[model samples]
Target: MKIKLEESTFGLLLASLLLIFGGVFSSAVQYDYTAVIDCLADPLKPQYNGGIIINPEINDGVKGWTTHGGVKIEQRSSISGNKYMVAHNRKQPYASVSHKVLLEKDKLYTFSAWIQVAGKNTTVTALFKTGDGFEKVGAVEAQVGCWSMFKGGISVASSTPAELYFESNDTSVDIWVDSVSLQPFTNEEWRSHQEQSIQKVRKSNMRLQVVDQNGRPIPNANITIQQNRLRFPLGASINQNIVRNTAYQNWFTQRFTVTTFENEMKWYTTENTQGREDYSAADSMLAFTSQHRISVRGHNIFWDDPQYQPWWVKNLSPQSLGPATDKRLNSVVSRYRGRVIAWDVNNENLHFNFYESKLGGGITNKFFQRTRQLDRRAMLFMNDYNTIEDGRDSTSSPSKYIAKLRQLQASLGANSVIGIGLEGHFHTVNIAYVRSALDTLAATRMPIWITELDVQAGPSQAAYFEQILREVHAHPGIQGIVIWGPWSQNGQCYQMCLVDPSFRNLAPGNVLDKLIHEWGGATAQATTNDNGYIDVSLFHGDYEAKFVPQGGRVDEVSPQGKSLSFAVDHNSSGQVIKFVSHV
Candidate 1:
């Protein structure tokens, strides 16, 4: 059952249980996922550009990977000279070392790599960071090292379709990369990523700088910053020791021009304060996602719980939560009608006992009516966990969760219910349960997503990622999988991060790569002017405006790329056409 964020029952239980839970899973790699792609190229040779880790002196006696018209193609160690040397691919192309991976929506990923550029711009650098559907990183920098053996690594964050690279701000620089890898980082790990290394703590010349929103600098901001993570598990991270790095490296080929809600829209925090009806958080999420041209899910327009509704709701004298709730729903919805694309009309009704028991049998209908009345254009979904096979029996049960959902669909009339959210927040949850859940949910003819998934504790976690992803990807009805908390830093609940605090990738993060950006078949085109303005019609996927080129595609791009997922939206009347330009 969905619990409120402030619910002490679970919070106290979890807090009390945290010791046991933490101990039980301590050595289990907290992260069990694996790495998928491997950059086996070597640098120092004229042909290999910056995509390798070793420094091999090629003198017509050896061969290696090289670049042409910007695309790095794998060639047997043949011609080793400046002629066949490094030319940045205006297009970022990559040679495949592909392995199977599973990516869940909502889960965060932490990507780390050692990248260095000495002279010319490192365009189409290594596939520094990429994935099927992720778009942005706040900041990264080109670090310096004495040599290949001492190359420096930069830590960054990414979602699915992860990316990593040495984006050269200077056009006349050469960058070398080695030991590039990515893994998932959960909430707690996020806290730990910023911890001070024992060595750094002992440094004498280390002077810390404090800054503010405009970057004018602030002396006291450090105090507030430190307070944020203070209660976290790691001591220094709580000190707000994370660097306020400027000129952060932008690795992806695309930017999430649009914005999104917190953690793919959870039911708990959305309206926990009740009559207060504060949507600042959600509005901020949508607006950010939208400004970045990122599409966002409306999460759930209707979840069945008193906490979701204001206390004034349950106290409705005549039983109605008042036109305020309805008006609020309609107001918030209508504001984002076209921009916000999807909605979970109802969330986990089958998992809990709700107001429907007291209200008439109209729980589902009321939700649909309000949503349709406001955002008539949004896609509506009936989201639930346990949609896969039953965890208890491992059999695709038509009688339990799916059955109730189907009954709700029939009762609510199928037209209003557009999809299913098979949230795989498994505690003891298994792939069999997820698979079965999707099979039955798909029978309703609605597209599905593995909404809020968490591959709970132990060595089996990585395998859990692979199994669930393989099964989910194999299913035609599953459109997306939003894993709960990709990083440990933001996890309000537990420690399910794919990578731990040390900026390491878990095996699961590796497997999920295939699921994220590797959906394949992508092409991009855009134009820029002296004002650095550009206009273009990108496809229904992620894209970045880069001067660098990948393999087999267009050009006039930036050394750094940005992406936004573009999907079709058909209105009953006609298609909603949009024209956008980015700076």
Candidate 2:
């Protein structure tokens, strides 16, 4: 009764199934599972086929590869008969194998390679020596025994001849590389991939069929679907101004279903005078958000930056600092335990380590453990900036982030629930780098959210904001996004503002509104077919459907309109709902 089929055979069978079920379930959505299977089956294999690199597989004995920076290049084979290129006896960091290739102007090129090291683990960077200078395309931590895949890309502004090379800072280790690939894609092709990913990940098909009591088809019924809530958490940060300003409340509540206070819940804000505490502003904001059914992400429990600490706590001894931090954690976390969805436990821990430097190295782990105990339902996040926004920041790179996460996991045990919160504050958007960074972090399989997203103020600010939003939303790894821009009456914002003083939308605000509309914020209408069935693809959310009998007056059929509530989610692919008609 059981059968095992080869990949090609399974593909043929999948095609047959599609043909067989395509008409019988015309209203249901069909997904091609071949790609998923292929990805999971052989992840170490190279994905690019049309790359420009010559002798990428090393089968021709390193015909196209040459020594760079006076190193030795040779083609070697493994016991399994797999050929690879090796660069040995390195004197400098950039001493490795190099390949020259002509790159096109205004094109995006994605690079990948399988690498390993002869001795200890080291970070290997893939670089391109272009007409301008040396450009780092990608990097990976190469290990001793196993092969690791390095993925990254670069966008060129002008056509130039470039020499692609690999580099390792450790001169004692020999680098082994295989399956080198450099594939280029046009802007249109890249956008098309994003759209396709969005359609597959964020949407589901729903089929509505109307029938009489006797199971007879009631044709020509008008169906109206209005989305009530979007499941994807697209929200913004808010300041205390929202508590009393009616215009501010309206503007915020209309678009966002989630929010985070700008500063109300921080340790410095709540306990400025050490023993004295205040939660009135935070309580009021929470009340407003609770009334509107908006979920909140706790802005922070503590800040690692020395400048952001409370004035009174700065001069405290280690003994006093420990107790004071415990009190702060208990007061805030216990006060709003079940109300918030996530907590930025130690904000900017990677960039600054005020508590760590004063208390000890174990302070952050202790805080995370205690926060989990206090608010068991909330996700504890390690939030930091520049991990994805600026790849040049080695202090908070994706690899470093993962290393910190692993250290915490080792200390907290395997079952600890931690979230990755990247504060996406950017100036000029780098689309390829962003995607590659996300891909690298997503390998950990941890829940990732863009905690504080904003672009610097400029003429291209709106465009960059739109690019970031689209790219993050299209990525399946990103679970949520919260914009950092908060509105003020004087038009002063952290970096970018969605609206001006008069409550009119700014350019960035307009971009957000347009995207919200495209992602199922607008009401839609459709008519049933001859079989009383209507199929539609919708973003995952709560929806209200109204059925109007054909040829009947709008008010004549039920004044309230024959309506029903339904939900569309990832598991709603073949979901069928039947509405009974009295007419």
Candidate 3:
């Protein structure tokens, strides 16, 4: 017989039936297993053999590879399974080995190999033929003795077929290349590889507190921990007045986290190469940075570029260059020893060797050693340009620059050069090339700073600026970036300045401003609750907290009742902070 039952009673009866035959009922539960099964399985990345080259090992002797200019099969030391190809410079400028491959549009390909230098420093560059010319994908400096593995990637923009090749240059060195491989990486794989190489440097959390002179908690403190990364000195640069200009200063103050006195601290500008010092401009620049509580980078202790050198330095006899260098370095470094955090010991040593040409190559070693001796506190940097912006073939490619640093490190005992300064002066940028260069230099394990980063004024300047800034921020190896200017001479316009002459933000400057504010560093108001304490977290930087005391009746003379302003910097961890409000 059918029994009439309420909805609740019927559900209970159904649950009871299911419980009595759990295994039978479970089969009818109905579940989607596709996503779960896929999650449990490993990801697949397909590799096509003989797609790019056959017998890449070259053990069978350059069978499928074509030689360009002076390349041959060599029995030299092998990187992997034995046998390799050697590109002999033999006093010539360049030699290369190449293989042709048909690539699809929009696919990403990476070409990698193990290479070693038989003689002097060897530079290996990855290239692809483009409509206009050969495009350089990556370059690396292989050491003379050991095998170094290097790889570079390319994003195919068009469906056109191109020959992918590895070329070695430098009259002084011969290169042995082995185990060449060309393969396509999935988006996930490429991103994962990039993420793995990126250094993990998390943003620091700053803990802050406010208290009165009697050590009592000061409730209702208005805290402004405005983190101007420009002020924090993240993408910092040398400037005389952006920190002080009314129309432009706000953009600079709110955006940049650091400052550098570009011309004020130069040897020629400071001493005029006559040994007479002018501390006024430099002092002002330092004071401005100090008042803002931003870090400062010393532009240069010595710059030996021939055309830019002081007239007196040029006239100095070969023997006098040494003494002049010593005097200049000692005088400048001693003045700003503890104040400046980093010093460009000798600017553009990679591009120019005026001092080296005259005082001998050993002079650069002496320059670093001497700088370290006097200014033992600061990070001494060997500043140069084109290391990242120019391709591997340029005089200042990452591979060549690293080799130069290695030479300096070998002679100066390692500690002499503590930082690598990359002058990121670019007109056009290839993100892949820049990333590859930085990755190669990161192998040095030294802190890398974008010393003179600026994009030229152009239609795409703003877009390029944002792209590069994001790239730099994403890279773990990049410690900080120092931009070139707020404006160039005569207001003609230059790359990297945030504001125009009218104090209006250029597109890039606006981008800079938006980034700084979006980081959301400071809390406008954090009132203390009934417990008479307010705990807040901030970005790792300096802060100013204004404490407004309550409870006392307001007087006509002091309506706010004696508000106290305290300048404090937040440490890594949020700690119980006691601020002495009254003296």
Candidate 4:
């Protein structure tokens, strides 16, 4: 019956202590249950790096791993990547850089590096394809190297795991690839790899074929090829989205990359204004051409005429205006220095009042000197209108241009000048004109190009297109044709759009498939059985080609005809031999 203070106090303290401990234990249990786990393995755990002759592995401590095909690994010292302990270098052209990583196709991943120029022309790349559909993805740049980093990335194809690649040109190039690895994302670890791959490929920059109503790679759509390699994957449908945006890039535009302008660089654009000397407009236009992957001709840098020369310069003595003209030449040529495939240093110097007569002879010489000074790489061309137009023998005019070209060469050395361009801007280009021009320019025994030939397609569109293609293809001296005004913006003068204003196929575009089919070979691969056939690698396009019972060497066409290009699904399977004769 006696109340004990100790007992009461002890019971209260015990009860309170138990409640506190229970609350703490409950929180610990809840925290453990809700915590996120990381099941993804770290990719960098593997060993890779080596050197060639001196030491085999990438570096002294670098390790190597294997995948498909034969691979060689070695360590190559580089000017850059000096901070990095060592560099992993490989020279296999077929598979320059390949990695097996945990990649869900559509996920956003970045593969970047500091690549230096090891050769005259070099490219650093990463390649991968989707499904049996074979949709490939990679990156390429023209003439880049060590001064800075060359970077590229693309979304991967959905579904099938691809042989991811990074390759470069055969021309000896030392690419210091550092910080090379796959990127991270939230959904890649948790969600579907297919969706992630789809996003990767969808956001990628490489061109792909379009889909049909059935969501298959469009069969006959034209896409560009690069470095003698097929643009798209062998069996994958090209992402139509990729092509529409990339139609203008140089190599990625189509299998058949061509010149859009022939000889439109003229007095109008160059000397449009009077005394106000200007070249920013021309530079912008040239940059645009380069960006769109279009090549250009110089037109005529110095044409003999009252209009070509500024009104103020005409009255001034040639000697007085020399500095300003030199400045003009330097600016014009330098702005488009390497970008221009070729340039007409002085147009029609022999026929018209050239800078030689007014300024002095060897003015063409000065022009070439200045051009080479800025860009020793650009091909200096001497172009002239009418010398090769209308099927007439350009015996007099072309002969004169050639004579001057020869004289220039004689004065300098044989290699001083690279090529002689013949401007063939014609109202109606005839076979005779082509022959006459070639015949005259051939006398010079120099490399020649048909600078501008706008073959009128009013009534004779089909005939003219066939004739031009055949003639140009046959000419040996002629390097290539630059068709001026090929597009609407360019062809405003000649209405040269292959697809007319109404978006209809123009004369040239209509029969172009046939020409390509005849010349383009069908390098068929894979053998068809119950489920078609299989081949390791096949180039893209319609494979608009024909092969004999015994197909010639791999990637070779029959003597009967040229192999045509074809479109294949990046994800299609089997030994598939398409028997279509014409594209």
- TM per candidate: 0.44, 0.89, 0.72, 0.44
Best to worst by TM-score, what's the order? 2, 3, 4, 1
- Determine which window of 10 residues in candidate 2 has minimal summed lDDT: 33-42
Residue-wise C-alpha lDDT for candidate 4, range 102-126, written one tens digit per residue: 4455444433333333455444444
- Whichever of 1 and 4 has more TM-score, that candidate is 4
Q: Give the top-scoring candidate (TM-score).
A: 2
Error of 1 at 579 (Å): 26
Report the CA-based lDDT of candidate 3 relative to the real structure. Answer: 0.63
Runs off by more than 4 Å, candidate 1? 1-260, 263-275, 305-324, 393-397, 400-417, 428-433, 488-495, 499-504, 514-518, 521-583
Top lDDT hit: 2
- The global C-alpha lDDT for each of the candidates, from Candidate 1 onward, is 0.39, 0.81, 0.63, 0.44
Model 3 stretches astray by more than 4 angstroms: 1-95, 102-111, 117-121, 141-145, 169-175, 181-199, 204-232, 242-244, 414-417, 518-583
Task: Write model 3 residue lDDT over 274-365, tens digit each, in one string.
Answer: 86778778887787778876688888887868887877889989888788888888888888899999988778887888988888878888
Candidate 2: tens digits of C-alpha lDDT, residues 1-583? 2223334454444333333232232212211111111111112555465288888888889888898999998998887778888999999999999999998986677777788889898888888999998777767767787777756778777999999999888999999988887877666445545555666678876788888768887777887889998989999999888999999999998899999999899988888786889999999999999999999999899999999999988899998999999999999999999999999999999999999998999999999888888888998899999887876666787777887887787777886768999999999776777777787777777899999999999999999999899989988788999999657779998899889987899999999999999888999988888999988878889998877666764456663437778888889887888877666
Q: For residues 1-583, could you state the per-residue lDDT of candidate 1 as single tens digits?
A: 2223233354444433332222231211132112111122233322213223222332332143243235342212323322212223334223221212233353333332333444532222223334543222211233332222111112223334333333333444444433333343333332121111111111111112222224333222101001111110100001011112111101110211212243324434445555444555566545444443445666666567555654545666534554544655665577668876677766666664355665556756676666776776777776665435333321223234444555656665655466666666655433322432344445556666666666776777766676565556545455655555544444332525654444345675565544343222223333333333332211123222223223323234322222222232111112321212121
lDDT of 1 at 293: 41
lDDT of 2 at 212: 77
